[model samples]
Target: MCKHILNAQVSIRAPCCKQWYDCAECHGESQTHPLAKTAEMAFICKKCKKAFRKNMSEYEESDEYCPHCDNHYVIEAKTPQAIVGVEGEDARVDNRMLKDDRVKQSTNRSLFTINSDDLTDKVG
Candidate 1:
């Protein structure tokens, strides 16, 4: 439900107000005060809906996952971007997105094909 980080896997509990947010930019938009920094951080995994805490001082590579569900919560955030695109489903999955109202060539013809009747009539 976060607008800033579209692919956020976990909600971080802000040390400042103890409120959960998907990203620091989201916290900044709703809260008036700046985020507080702390060595201990709390997070709620979106997949398993479980809460866990990690001490930044003792943080390790293994701490990047939720202890209860083993869901990898640490990942590169996918933020929204400003771009122009056709307003339709993915063209790869749905061909309708790529459909255009234009004249199409016949599939049952070849340039080298010649009518034998036309040649015989001309000879006669």
Candidate 2:
């Protein structure tokens, strides 16, 4: 069981392998090296989907609202989205059989509801 769940609040790009992680703890547990203080950090606003550079002076004093869309960043596990598949196979596929799950890439889109009874806020 993971102590902290990787959610939509923020993500850190590991300096060791340049891979995105939910936090330093995630990086430390998943990676071999420790995260340095000088390493770059970026926060993604769940509402706007815009990345806020942590190193920036402007962002250092910011709060919960996104600077781009002013939408409150929802700090929770996002709903599972429908996975979409690529049209063609990989060129260097040496194996004859391709797994069904491997054929498609999972993508999470924005949380804007077009039409639903669950939607309470109306933006026009």
Backbone clashes (count) for model 1: 0
The best candidate by TM-score is 1
Residue 119 CA error for candidate 2 (Å)? 75
Over the stretch 48-113, how does candidate 2's per-residue lDDT look in tens digits? Answer: 667775553344434556768876654466544668975566646744455456566435333574
Residue 107 of candidate 2: its Cα lDDT? 53
The CA lDDT of each predicted structure is 0.87, 0.59
Candidate 2, TM-score vs. the true structure?
Answer: 0.42
The top-ranked prediction according to lDDT is 1
TM-score for each candidate, following the candidate numbering = 0.69, 0.42
lDDT for model 1 comes to 0.87
lDDT digits (tens) for residues 1-124 of candidate 1:
9998899999999998989998999999999999999999999999999888999999999998899999988889888899996688777888965658899975654445566744532331
